[model samples]
Target: MTSASFHPTITLPASLCEQAAQHLEQAVQRAVDGAAAPWRAFRRAESSDYTLSVSVVEQAAASLLVLAAESAQSMRPSALRALISVALHLRDAADATRRPTFTTTLW
Candidate 1:
């Protein structure tokens, strides 16, 4: 768990990154719900047209890229979780499939 590790940040127009996470969670839940729609709560904060944080911007930018790249995508939580799981497993498989060269790790 070093600084280089992947810790995602998502900053939306209405609230902080955490708020965006919460909204995404709710949106996913909504996709599965046959029940009465829960009252969605979002605190509206003025979108700083000029507000700039490099990390937050980078995280949001990455998400935009993923979103833009995908077609007929599922924004649902379950789907996202499954996609992440599959990606992780596939990545592991690919790594395992590789011929280990001491070259990559060689001093």
Candidate 2:
């Protein structure tokens, strides 16, 4: 049996590379913060208001998707603009689908 592996390479201007790096860092930080937020809330989830607690948790998770869309938009790489747009649309759809409702279904 034979297996194949591929490595891809891309080159961009120094400034663009720097911008992309910054955007990536920001996106990672946002993701980390978004994840931490819900954990923090969960730790203090003894609140009397169940509705507010659920709302906060939902918002925190949704924030990760929003950050991804914003990060892609911020990078604005011409070559990947369309792909980014599609990703943003998908993220939005996911956020919409995850909207808080009376019925909570776990799959």
The lDDT for every candidate, in the order shown, is 0.36, 0.42
Cα miss at 70, model 2 (Å)? Answer: 5.1
Which lDDT value does model 1 have at 89?
A: 36
Q: Where does candidate 1 stray beyond 4 Å?
A: 1-74, 99-107
Q: Could you give candidate 2's per-residue lDDT for residues 28-51 as a string of tens digits?
A: 566645545444443343342222
Write one digit per residue (lDDT tens) for candidate 1, span 1-107.
Answer: 88778443322343343333343344344442311121122122233332333343333333323432352265666655544443343234334434465666657
If scored against the real structure, what TM-score would every candidate get?
0.25, 0.30
What is the overall TM-score of model 2 with all chains considered together? 0.30
Clashes of each: 0, 0
Q: Which residue pairs show collisions in model 2?
A: none
